[model samples]
Each structure stands twice: as structure tokens, then as C-alpha cells.
Target: MRLRELLDATELGLLLLVGHDTDDTDDNDGIPPGTPLDRTISAVATNDLSDPGRFLTGGELVLTGLAWWQGDGDAESFVRVLHRAGVTALAAGEVEHGLVPHDLVRACRRHGLPLIAVRPETSFAAITEHVLRRLHRRDPGSLAGLAALVERHRRLLTDRAAPDSVLELLRHTLGFDVRVLSATGRQVAGARPPLRAKTAAALAARYLAARRAGESAPHHVTVGGRPYSLVPVPAPAPVRVPVPGPGPLPHPHPHPHPAELGDWLLVVEADTSLWATPDRELLDRTVELVADARAAREQANTARNDLADRSLALLHSDVPAEEIPLRLRSTAQAVVSGVGYWPRLQFVVAAGEWHAARPVPAAALRVLLEEALLQEDGPVPVSSEDIAATVDGDRAVLLVLVPGPSEAHPDPALDHAALERRLSAALARWLGPADSVSIGVSSPVPEPGNARRALEQAHNALRIAHAAPGQVTVRGPEDLTSHILSLLPLIPAEARRAFATRLLGPLRDHDARHRTDLLTTLETFLDCDASWTACAARLHLHVNSLRQRIARIEHLTQRDLSRLETRLDFLAALKSG
Candidate 1:
């Protein structure tokens, strides 16, 4: 409140000589001096004192006693000072210094100074007290009122009544509009009337500038000639919980939104000085509510994503293989809408102990994968957990289910090469130098029931990834041979091991006795399929030596090399080994 404005309401014996407005007389007009001065007084004194420039401009009750003069010679000088200083009125004290000084009265009447006489017992302190009370009528009575409002607003927001409701409450009760924006200054929610845009823009800009300078710095802005104070809310990272560290400090960047991205701001705007004690307190509470809500929302999203991922894993197993396509379709609809039909299906998986420790938080991971798939400028659907992703035709599908094809891009023209590069780079940036991720991609196969096969193929490629070094995507059916063998549905683990032992028992014993090169020779010969020259070239041996080793093996095992059964047994043993 400006001093002039405060004084205007004080109605104590205030009269104006250089009055520009018609209502210059004190509000308590027609009242005599002895009638207890009941009004607030604020009269501007035009009279010059020792320091001529210190005149009150627009206050009530400017008093003059001709006290600055001793007689006639001084009286006229005093009147000249009063006129030049722009004093509104001069009250001449009679009893203290005798009846109104003749020269002073004559000067006041000549200059039209609304002059009054003060009695001997009048105290300035009594008048000052009356004025103070009137000026403070609307302000919060005590500090507690401000503190209470701040806490109340915080609790109201925590009740989960959307942000809009909170803003409405503030506007209705506080008589000002509110706006919420992201860290990037993008408006989240708020009223933006055309009339208030300029004012709002200026205030918002100033507040943001101050916040950027130092988030903890509180700023005051005047919009539409009305003052407003803005304080920034600190957005903490999702992983940063209230653990023991150096407790919470104001963020250097005063972005009202969450610092970790994808958060919002809580901006409160009100008339200057109208942000009573109560409003300031409520603002504090609002900040806490927003931070807690953001944190809770992040957690909920993580849990939901976890459940979806687990559901997908369940769909991948337990269910009969043939039902995979149907299952994928159902899950796809549940996770992302408008997705149906899949042409080419490729499965990919990343594994290792390193992957476990710093696993992508479910929501963040989901978002990253979705962002890669969608390439959209808007919000991407990612939970705060792990990134389990799928791609269907046009829609980069996410959420867990059988690796299936989508109708949008039915031709299973899998971009195996491009996808491998993307996965490598994304994981590299995400995991940093400490971790390693091995991605195995299944060759794009025909759609429908083959979804399960594609997933199995990808899984197999991942299993044998060690064999192919420096590779992220181990694709194609060949990479998964070991897995194929396991899926034979005919040979149990123990039986397969026993069979491998029986067939290679002769060669094992022979090698053990003579330290012979029989196993190498057999593997090479079998790889060459009885071609002596090629087998010898591969073994780096003379053809004759190779023949001798082969003959010795045959003699010991009692299985002729020329026979189909003997060759089949050797081949099976080699495969198992």
C-alpha cells in the first residue's frame, strides 16, 4: 500500500489548500475541533521547515503554529515557505503560544490555507494510532493466519482433486489467477485472459528470469500496476528420495517443474500485497503437494508397467505355442490401442549381470523404447520400470506379449541391421561405460503362429551370442541351433548326454591313451563329408596322414567310415558336444 493511499483514508482535521479534487476536505467535515478527532488524518504540508524540501506531499492534517517565526518579520516568511512547499492546510495552536498569531492568520487567509486551531491537550500519538488501525484493517492479524493457509492448500492438493480444482480454489479465495508451466516455460494449466496477457506475460517472464538466476530467490513483479510475488518450487529427481544426504536444498535451476523432465510447475499469482500472510503460507503448502503428487504418480506408473511386463512374460510361456498370435493380439490391444495384425515378427532380448544392477527404471525404460519406436514429438508412453518393447507395422508396439506382426506393416521386412545399430547406441548412451548389453534379434519370419518361433529364435541367438564376438544382434535360425536341439521333444538332457558319450566313447578313450588328434581329424573330416583333400587342407595335414588318423579311428570304434549309420552317430555326437 502506497503511503499516499494509506493517508487518504485517515480523516483527522485534514484540509487542503492546493486541492485539485473536490473531495479535498477531511471526511469528518462540519465537525468542530473539540469533538474527539475520530478520523485518520493525512495532510500534505507545503510549509517549509529548516530543510525546505521535506514537505509531506499528500498526507492529512498538515499543522502550522507560526512556531518557525518570532514576530511579523518571520510570519510572512513562514507563509511564503508554506505556499512554496505545497502544504494543504495549517493548524495554528492557540493556547500553547497564545491566541492565533495575527500575522499567521492574515497570511493563512490570504493564501487560502485551510487553517484550524489545535487545543493545548491534543496528542499526536493518539492521532497516529487511529490512522495505523484503519490502514491495517484488512491485513492478516498475525503470522499464524499466513502459516495456516499455506498448510491448508498443501493438504487440499494431496486430496487428489485435480490441479484445476486447486487453481479455482486459489482464484476464488485469493482474487487472482494462477498458471502452471513445465520447466521449459510451456504452459501446463491456467487462465490466460486476453486482457491480462500482457501483465501476466511480464510478471511470468520476470519471475522465470529471477528463478533462473537463482531458484531460491524470491521475486516481486508488478503487473497491471498491481504487485505480485512469485516463488519457485523445486523439482527433485525421481530417484532422489528423502534419504540422508545434505537434506533438500533449493535447486540451482528454479524450474517449477520436476528437474528430471516430464514434470509440471505450480505458479501462484495474486495482487501485490494481497498475498496476505495466509496466501504466502498456502503457497508453501501447494509446493509440497505438487512435489509429492509428481513422485507418487511416477511410482504408480512404475507399478503398472511392471504388471504389464510380467503379464507379457506369462503370455510368452505357459500358453500353448499355437495360441501365441491370439494372445499377442489381445495383449497389444490392452497395452496400446489401434494395433492389430503383424506381418514380420522379430524378437530381441538383452541380458547379463551388468544389466541387472542398473536396470532401467520401468517407466523410464518404457518411455525410451516407446520414443524410439514412435518418433513422436508429443508424450510417449513409458512406465517407470523396464523397457519391454515390440514393433508392429506402423505402430511401434510396446507392452509385453508374444513377438507378433502388425497389419500396419505386414511385410515382415525386418530392419535387422538398422535396429541393431539403434539398440546398440541407445543402450550405450543409457548404460554408460560400466555396463554391457547383448541384443539378439530373430530374423523376421512369417506372421501368425510363428510369433512364438520368432521369440524362441531370438532367445537362442542370445544364448550363443558369446560365439559371435563384438556383435549386438545375433540373428537368423542358425544362431539358435542349441535351443532347437533342446526343443526336440525327443531327447531329454541326460539321455542326450548319454548318447553323445556312447558314440564318442571310442574316440575319447583313444585320445586319452595316445594323446591322438582323432577328435580334430573326425570333426574336420565330418565337416568335409569324406572329402579327403578338403579335410586334409582344413586340418593342415598331408592327405595320407589324415587317412591314417581316420583309419585308426575306424579300427578302434569298429564302425566303418563308409557306412551311413556310423557317419550319423559321429555327426550326432559332434552336434551334442
Candidate 2:
């Protein structure tokens, strides 16, 4: 508050007094020798006597009766010192000095500082106290509004509310245009009209890049070929879980856009001018609210899943056949379909550390499982369980059951080799040992009752795949269920182990001693379709090293590993054990 405003409220009249030829202070307010001041002054000091350099601090409305400086030279030096020190207003007291000096008043008038005179008896302390009290009082209305925003957004974040839901809420609450963008900047949920695919694609890369960079400032990007402001919804502080192997470290970024309790971004597509000081505070609070909502919703879903998984465990134990179907359906519905009927189901199980970041939301993961069976290409009525509910421990697990393919079969010519090649081609897209996944596909089972048997079959196939020599192993039921004890069954586990032991034994010993990649070569070899060229491409290994391992395997096992029979026998033996 300005001095004038403070004095006005107190209903006190102040007299004007300026010193002559004493250019001691700037035109803003020059206090010359002998000027009377009535207001009760705080911190009275002389400028000319001091260093004239650091005498007055900027905020102190300096009260000086410039009695120390009389000459123009002294006045000029005083004015420079006061300006440098950042004094707000200078009051000249007349009773202590004399009548107002014209030169001092003119100089102060020139500089535009509020010049005020106070009678000798007026009190400045009273004025200061009054002003401070007014500022301390809080406005009830504003406080109430803040409380409401906090209460509302907490649930949204916890539920993992879609961006669209928040936009809808914004329309009714904030009364402004809101756009919810994906990490790719594509308008995932918003009031904005539909955009062209090309435009969405174009902006997606930029938005995703910015998101990955964890940009806090409102990024300026073109959306739907028009300029839009992107305010990232606040994400809840990433929940860290301790697990085996190296995990992603916390890399927090200061988010610039408004977010509430949850980690949802509150992207406002409005003019930048709306960001006033008050609004900035509101935006920050809103982010917190969003974060809260996300956390709450996630916790609720997790609790729900925990309960369902417990139920599934009970169902998995030996139970009556008649009771089995009802129990399985109940478990599926309770966990996977909290709402309407899920005609399609996919069950996915993790075999490695793939979902380190809560890769799937509980509800979404369940939905993904339900939909995995609907693919029209090869199988139908498939059930997939790759959702968040079952993605536990080191390996992520999923079971996918579709609507058809009750009796799909591999051609006699297409044996294990052809299938392995096909599976490798399909799974090559997912790279890295850290993300190794084994998929066991079961023939599609009829829905409403077949999920249990299908899940069992898929689990069996997964076990077979795990026994195979690759990071990603795939299999179906035929290999295990066939009545004929094919040549594959005749292969001895000792021979297969000996082959791997001989080929990679030296490397394993070195690895155990030095943590090396001798087994990694074998891991990559099977991943590379057992071809020298493919393995080389995958591992960047020379042909000679791969041949050496194969030769070593053959020498130690006393069998030609290059032959299809030998490879199949080895693979079966590995799985059998």
C-alpha cells in the first residue's frame, strides 16, 4: 500500500515542506534542510552525511528532513544516493528544519515521487499497523473455491480417468475451452472437433517427444492444424516398487501446466493472458487434485484385483467339474468384467520383468484380455490376461481366448521348425533380454464356460516354451497331448543339456566368474532362427563364433546338431525336463 493511501484512511492531514537549493534527494522526493513532517516517521536518517551510496534501502519510504545538506552540490549527491538505495518516498519535516524550500520541492516534483508533509505530532506507526492488519485477513470465498477443486479432482486421478472425462468436467467447472491430448499430442479427449489423421500424426511425435522430455512449460504446438496450448495433466508421482534387476529411477520434472491432485495434465486451450497470479496458484492446486484422483482410482482398482486374484487362486485348486465353470466365470466376471459382458477374453502371463511401470491399468488390462479373442485372422474366442490384474512378479502373464478355432492344427510338414520360425518372426518386434516373454497359445475355446480349460492349456504351452532355448518361446497343445511318443520324446534330456553345456559351458563358467554373455549367445541363437546370418544380424556376431558353438555342441553331444531331427530332439528334451 502506498503512503498516500495509508494516510488517507487515517483521516490525517499532512503539510507540504521542501528545502531550498538542497538537491540532496531525487525529484521523486527530495528532503532538504529544515522541513516539517507530521506523520509518525519510521527510521529517520540523513543521506548527505552517510556514504551517499548505500544509505537508503529500496523499500524503506525514507523519511528525511535534509538538515545535514545545504548546498546544491550536496543536494545533487544526496539525490543520487537515495535513488541508488531505492527509497520509496521521502517526507520532509518542517518544524525541525524550516519552511519548505522551493528547489528541493521542484526536484522532487520532477522525479515523480509522492512528496507528503506531516505535522510534527502525527504518528506513522499507527498507519503501518492498520495497513498490515488489512492484508492479513483472508477472503472466505476464495478459500471455499480452493477446497472444492481439491475434493473434485482427487477421484479423477485415482480412477485413471480418461482425458476426455476431465475435459468434460472442465467444460462445466472452469468454463473455458479444454483439450485433452495424448502424450503424442493427439486430441485423445477434448471439446474440440474431430481432427484429420495426418494432423494428429504430425503433432503426435512432437507431443510424445515433449512428454518424454518431461517438459513442464506449456508447449506451443499445432493441433488439428491450429495452434493449441498443451498443459500436461499432472501424473501422480510414479509409484515405485522394488523388484529384482535394475528398475527405472525417478526422474521428476517441474510441470508448468496446471494439474490438480493427480498426475493428469490440465491442458487449457485458451489465451495465455488468463494466467494471472491467482490463476497460477489455482493451476498448481488443481494438479495436486488430479494426482490425488489418479492415486485413489488406482488404489481402488488394485484392491478390487487383489480380491479377484485371490478368488482365482481358490478356483485353481482342485474343485468339482460342475462347480468349476461357475467358479471360473465368477472369477473372470468379478475381476475382468466389473461392468458388462466381456464376450472375448485373453489371458497373458508375464515370464519376465516387462511391466515395470504398471504397463497396463487394471481396467484397461482386463479389457485388453477380453478383446484378445476377437481377432478375425487366425483364432477367435481367445482370452487374453495381459492386463494389470495378472501382470505380477518377474514375468508378465496373459491368457487370450478367442471365439473360434476349436480344432486348429499345424500341418504335418509345418512341424516344430516351421512353427518356431513363424513364432520368432512374430515376436521379433519385442527386443531385449530384459523384456523376454513366452507366449503359449491355446486353441480357441467356447466362451461362457471354456476359459478354465483354455487357461490350463495356455499355461501348459507356456511351460513347454520356457523349456525351449530362447528368450521368447511359443507353443500349442499338440506337442504335449499327441498320443504317439514321437521321435522328439525319445531325445534324452542329458544329451540336450550336454550339448548346451559343451557349447556354452566355457562361456557359462566365464560368465559366473566375470558375468559374461556365453549363454547369451545361445539365447540369441535360438532367437535368431538358428541361422548363422540371422544370429549375426541379431547379435552382431561373426559367423566363426556361431559355428564354433554349433561344432562344440555336436562334438560334446556326439550328434549332428545341424540336422532338423537333432534340433527338434534337443528342443523336446529341453521341454520334457
Candidate 3:
């Protein structure tokens, strides 16, 4: 406690002769008047000796009964020792000596230490008891203060405060470093100074895994060798209890089941096992506040998502080019700030395998794409600005704003390629190797007027990706072969079969009737780049025999194999079959 507080306390009010600085200077023994009274009295030491410095560890309100005083020199020596030992204040009892001597007061004033005169009736033990009581009372007082702070935060959340604002309040009031993460392990808020993307992802994955395993929350886990408490903030209760009604009562689910997804997590930087009851209670309240904030944020996001979906639908419709920009202005501004015009646009389509009856997890893919966009090392770090929509049950489409030439690293292709790589890796982790996901990215379009074209391109690319060997396939304008192959799927099955039959029907019938290898020879000849020697070696036939089979194939199909046009037609017909 401050010396002034001790002097003013009711228990010590009768004890007079409190020392004060005579000068007008603001210094009160190097401690200002407004200093907190929270400093603990480490111990109370009573000494009559001229040298009592060895027993003091500073911050003690030392008490002396003046039994060892002989003259001014003894008083000076005692005061100097107390001051040198870093005593906070001096209390001199006037019981035995009848009055506090002028020499000790002068010595205290010279040394800049506050001196208190203890009444003859006040015992040394009484003063020590008072100090200890006040010090011990601070713990409960601090707990009450913390509870009040938490209540204020809860009120702020109820008043519709921003989630980050509530988190900032908690950090400032409680002095705890904390973060809130989504179910996908992406940071939702409270990443001041920002955790590394990988670290955040790891923490999120651990939290989700624990929840999936039915482990209770506010559990402890170590990240980067520092212990943190993972507290699950469940979704808000859907049904409220009635006021003792007579009808069938509603069963409210207060807790989330393990299978229910999208629950957020609070990651406190300290282990809860070491926390006191009040601290634990405060943490529980913090989780509730975060959940409320999250619910509100999700509501806002739903509105934004609705806007984006409508904007995309309009762009894909028969809207005029001039009218398209007007309709997309609000959503484009919302998705990517500070853009008067989205000069370039790229479309991305993502899909995964599921049962024929079960819908693909397009929502999960959207979350994954959004998280990938937040990665600092990702190719398109600006992906966070992109608008992603679950266009259908099986697919999600992203409308990305391409950086302009004046912007830094303005190469959109490189950025898109990098995003493709990172996204594929993340998807591979989410959906194992046996299950697959394919993402197709289109070449940049010039404006929103071309959104329909971009969407079609992205869709066609996705078809090619599904047929390709790997989990991801990007088909730009340069990939003419995949593009042509992608277009074939658009043809009706009857038409494709008719085309194949018209070109290869005679060969198939001849092979079946005569039990000859003409069809195989033709395929081998085409595959060997029309080289008679290679075709003959591959088929284990003489060059003359291969030549005879080729001649037979050309005569039956009525198409010259030597011409490039006929060669391509034969190849296409073979693929279609």
C-alpha cells in the first residue's frame, strides 16, 4: 500500500505525525501519489539496531520502537541503513521513548523517506496485522475485478460488438495472449502479430481432431513447446426451454455432438490445469462471448454470400454488358476493396468424389479454397479477395480478380499456377489419395461481361481435369488437345457413336469376320507415327506385310493415311469409339 493510504486508513488514523515533503517538487521519495497500492509487503521487520539492512529485501514498511536511539548519529545511521536497504517507508513507535525524536525525523527528511509516528497505544504487531490483511485482500479483489471485466465483454458482445473488438478487449483487460480459430483451423480472429499460417492450421487441425474424438474442451495441448488450452465454442442452442408449460416439452441440445461440424475453438495461451476456479470461470465466459461473436459474423457472411451468388447469377444470365457492371458493383466492391473496375477475372471450379446419391462436399472445398488464399507463401496471396460460390451441389466456383500491370508481380498465370499447386496439396490432405478432387482454373477474362465465357471455360477445364491422370488439371487456351477432348463430352452419345461407326465400322466388321489383325495394325501404325518399319516391328510382321495391311485399311475406310487431315480424322474416330 502507498504510505498515504496507510496514514489515512481508519486503523492507523489515530497515529499522527506523518512526514511529508516540504518542497513543492512532485517527487514523494521517488514514488508519485497516484502509484498503485498493490505492492505487497514482503515481510514486516522490527529492529532497534543501528544496522538492520541485512534483514530487509526491499518493499518492507519497516517498524522501529526507538529503543536503540542514543543521539542524532545513531538516528542518522539507522535511517541511512533502512534507506539503503530499499525500505518503502519507516514507522517509528513512540511507546518507550514517549515521543518520536526530531533527529530521526530530520534524518528521514534528509534521506527522502516517508516516516510515520506510531501512537503510544498502537502495538507493532497491530500495524503488521493491518498490512497483511490488506495485502491478502487484494487477491479476492482482483478476482472480482476480472469477473467484472469479463461481464463487460459479454455485454459488449450482446450489444453486437465485433468479434475482434471483443478479443482485443479480453487481451487488454486480462493480459492474456489468445486466438480464435474456425473448425477448418483457419484463423477467424485474434491473431495479433499473426501466427504463422502453418502453425494456425496445425492448431486448428488438432482442435478439430480432439472434437472428433469426443474429447472435452478447455483441454491442454502444446504448440511450439508452449502449452495452450483448446476450448470448443459450440453453436448456439437452437431451442429455448419453456416456462413450465403443460404440452410436450422441447428438448434443447445444449452441447454439440461430435458429428456436427463448424464449431469454433478458443486457443488460450496458458494451461487451464494450472488456473484457479475464477480464472477457469472467466475462460468459460470468454468462450461464450466468442461464440456469440462468431454467430453474428456468420450471419453477416451469409448475407455477403447471398449477394455474391446473385451477382454471379446475373453475370451468367442474359444481362447486357453495360448493365452487368452496374449489377456487380456492390458485390465486386465488397469482395475486393478499392477496385473501380475488375479489369481481369479468372474462374476456378472445384469438385470431389462422393456416392451417386450423396452430394459432394462443395462447402468444404470452398472453405479450403478460402484458407489457401490466406497463406502468405501461396501463389495468389490475394485470393482472400476472391469471391467463391457453391454454384452447385457438386462444384464450387471462384471469381478471382486478376492483378493489373501496375500492381506488384502482375503475372496472373504464375499466381494462378502457384495457387493451383497449394490448393491441390491441401485438398490431397483433406481428401486422401484414394479419393480425389479436381480443380480447373480458366485463363483471365477481360471483364465481368465475359463471366459466362469464363465459367464455361472453367467448366470445360474441369471436365478435362476429371479425365486427366492427376487430381488437378489446368486447361488454358494453349492446351488445344485437352480443349478439343473436353468439347467432345458436350456431344450427344448417339451422335458420337454415329460418327465413330461411320469411320471405323468396316474395319471392325472385317476384323470380326475374317479374324484378321487389320484394326490392331491400323492402331499400331497410327501410334508409330505412320512408320512402316516401326509398325512392322511392333506387330512382328515384315515391312511388306505392314504395307499391305495399311493399303487394305485405307481402301476399306476410303481415307488416305498419308494426309494430315485424314490422320487426325482417324485418330478422332478411334478416340470417339
Candidate 4:
């Protein structure tokens, strides 16, 4: 209800004072007469303390007995506290005192808080009851609107309508743009125009920072000079654990802890300063509906995720080759819609730096993989029909469908470089600075029959990626040379160390004792294609000095560099080291 309506009530009419009684026009003691008074009263709370700001929320109409008021200075402090707490108006009861004090009126005027003087006969209870009644009663015209919204939400929950459709309905009903975003800044659903990925990431970062600081929700932030309010869509409450009875101990079930870092946010593209009570209530209801939709989507995806996990497991297991294609077809069909056969499938393995105390990086990586595959903003839109599954600790596997020739666009060859660039950019945008991600993409396999081999190739390629200097490495057909070297990662750590030590141990010891450069000279000579002059020039040494160093290397290692087999063995030993 409006402040003007409250003032004009029959029982409260004479009690309402808009300004100071004194003839000081500049010192209007309360809210201006012609100013808008359409603010809604959320609740009425009575306080007798000198400071009641802690108990007050914005849009509240505070009732006071003024029992703590000792002098004029107290009035100023009390009114200022209420003003800062966003109390919409003040109602002072004169039951303790004969009338409302002039000091309180002057204080309210200075703070621009509307003041309603409670009459001696009219009770505070009556005013509170009236406000509560009005809050519960909906407008007759809005009843049908509410019904339509409920029906739309029901449809959304039942899968008859999509999540974007609900966002569109809200836009039509409320005339506001809204979007649902994951904690990592990936847009889940909404009515477009869509937010840029970079902007969304920045906003998500701000929301996360505020949450970490223990700030309450409905955070207001301005992006691109436009105001927006972010309200967290809280996670569903955890299931209550049953108390154990006087029986044998039951087997403990391991349920993954709910992710504390990633939360969904409802972003409203409007200034919160203009939001009325009805607007806020509507937004709250919308958040609930969005949360329900997200839950439903996740429930549906669980089955597909299970299928992906099973398929990957089967590929790694000793499954019959003939049956592999059949099983894979079923899994592929569940994730990629309208696909009878997956002719070419590429496997991606991603691993990230993680700590035991922090949330699993693989969980976050899975979301990033999904977002990367579903991204439509890039020059080449990544298809949404991809499956990403967390396989083990700090690692996830993604199955990407390689598009083939279509009538509209005949050239179906995938741009490997562009895809890698896009994936790297997405990783940089989402992952925190303390974390790092490395990904390896395998060459496309012809069919599901080759999936087992493809998975191994991808696994080996991921090892190479970790060994390589860059954050991302793609293992295509031409990378077979490194594939042989990549097998070293699969060896046991102790065995690899022993092999390196045995081959180069003597050379290292001799060099340490004599201050010689035999090992370096040998490696440089081999790298220079056994050319004496080139190796000498590269090492900034004379030909004779290089020859002497090589002679000492040969004498120590007891190997002739002239033999091709010996050269290969030395190269292998160097690689192991």
C-alpha cells in the first residue's frame, strides 16, 4: 500500500504529519507531499531500542514507542539508523508520551523519512494487521496473470515447454530481460539478446567473490554501464540422514558432497532501485521456477552421463570388438540426437592442477567441456550434441562428433586449429589463475569399432600434452613420431629412472669430477647429425676440442658413435633421462 493511502485513512488522517509544524519552509520535516508514495510495505515491526536498524529490512514500516528517547540528540541517531537500514517510513506511538516530540519530527525531516503519528486510541496492532492483510491479497486483475504463470511453470516442469520459453513468458509478463547463468559464467537458459561470454564470466566472478565474503544475496552490480541484480538460486536442501537404531551397523553409503563453489545465479538486467514489492515477489517466484527447470535438466542428463561413462569404460575394458559398435551406437544415440551412426568420433582428455583441499577440478572441467561444445557465439559454432564425462580424479573424457558433408555446407572437415583455439580461450575465461588445464585431442576414428584404440591414443596423447611445453596438444596422424616417445609416460617411474641412470650415470660422474662437458658435447654432436664442424660451431668450440670431448665420451660410455644403432641407443637414453 502507498504512504498516501495510509495517511488518508479515516483513523490515521489527523495523525499523519508530512512536515514540521514550524513555519520554516526550507525545513520540511518529513517526506515531500507531492513525492511518489507508491512504495509497498513489506512488514511492520515494533522496536523500543535506541538502535533498531539491525532488526529492519528495506521496505519495512517500523513502529516505535520512543521509550529510549532521552533528548533531541537521541532522535537524530534513531532516525538516521532507520534511514540507513532502508526503513520505508516510521510510525511513532504516543502511548508512553502525550504527543509526538518536535525533536523526532525535525530528525525525520532531515533524513527525509515519512512519519505517521500513532493516535492515542488507534492501536499499532490494527495498523500491522491491515498491512499484512493487504500484502496477502492479490489484485483481482493479477489473479489471471498468476494462473497463467503457474500453468507455464507446470509445463516447464513436465517438459512440455523449454526453459527458454519460461524466460520468454516472464519477459512478456514483466517486461524485463533475464538470464540464468552457471557459476563459471556459462549461460544455462534465458531470453536473448545473450550476454557475451567474457561479460558473463566477469559477473560470475563478482558473484562468487561476494558469496565467499558471506554477503547476502540480491547483489547489485553495474556492467557495461547498465545495472543488474544477481540473485543466487540456492541449491536444494540436503536429505536428512536417519538416526541409527539399536541394530547392527549399516554399510555407509558415499554421497558426493554438494559443490560449494559453483552455484546458479538469476541475473536481472534492471536497476534494483526501481523494483517494487510486486516486482521483487515476481522475481523470487521466477527464481524458483528456474531452479526447478535446472534440476529437471540435470536429472535428464544423468542418464546420458551414465551412458557416456559406461561407453568409455567398455572401450577401456576387454570388451568384444564385434559388440563394441553396438553398445557405442546406443550410447551415442542417447547423447547426440538424430544420429543413427557416429561415423567419426574424436576423443578429448583433459586434466588440471588440483589440490586435495579444493573442490575437484575435474568437476569444473566437465562443465567447461560442456560449455565449449555448446558454445554458439564463435565463428564456427560448436555443436551441442557432445558428451563429457568425468572418468577419474582430476581427469575427464569428452566425445565430440565430427560433422560430415551436408547439403547446405558440403565441406565438413573440422578446423582443428580453430577448435583448439576456442577451447583454450574458454579454459582461460573460466578457470581461476591458481589452476591450470591441459587438454589432448585425438585424431578422429572411423567408427565405434575403433573406439578402444582411439581411447588409448587419446590417453597417450594426453600424456604427451602434459609432457609438452604448451597447455594444449592435439595428436593427429602426423604426431606418430612423438607417439613412440609418449609411451615412456606409461612406464613405471622407478624403471624409467633406473634406465636413465644406468645409461648416463658414468658420463655424469666423470663430468662432475673433471669439470668436463662430455654429455653436452655428445648430445650436441648427435643433434647436429654427427657433423664435427657444425657441433663445434654450435658449442662455440674448435673442431679439435669437440673431437677430443667426443673421444672422451666414447671412451667413458664404451660406444662407437659411427654405428647407427649406437646413435639410436644414445638418443633413447637421452630421452629417458
Models sorted by lDDT, best on top: 4, 3, 1, 2
RMSD of each: 24.0, 23.7, 18.4, 18.6
| Shift in Å, residue 521, candidate 3 | 38
Question: Is candidate 2 or 4 superior in lDDT?
Answer: 4
lDDT of 1 by residue, 285-313 (tens): 65566666555545445543543464447
How large an RMSD does model 2 have? 23.7
Backbone clash total, candidate 4: 1
Best by the TM-score measure: 3
lDDT of 3 by residue, 166-285 (tens): 565444333356788765566678846667766666676666556544567776888898778888876544211112223422222222222223456787776767655655676777
Q: Is candidate 1 or 4 superior in TM-score? A: 4
Candidate with maximal lDDT:
4
Question: Each model's C-alpha lDDT?
Answer: 0.47, 0.45, 0.62, 0.63
**Alpha-carbon deviation at 300 in model 2, angstroms:** 6.1
Clashes of each: 34, 112, 0, 1
TM-score of candidate 1 to 2 decimals? 0.32
lDDT of 4 by residue, 1-577 (tens): 7666666668654365643343233333333344535555555566666876644545667777788887767798898888777777788988778888889888877777778889788776567656645655645454454456556565657763456666654543444567888666778788565798677867776776566445677889887887888888754332111222234322232223223233678887766545556657767777778777767755656666676687878776787776887888887777666777754657777765522223334555565565555555433345544454545555778776565535875433345565456555534433344434566666555557557655665666666665665544444423433555677789887887787788788899998999988888888976654655557878999977987887788888888775544664676678888
lDDT head-to-head 1 vs 2, winner: 1
RMSD of 4: 18.6
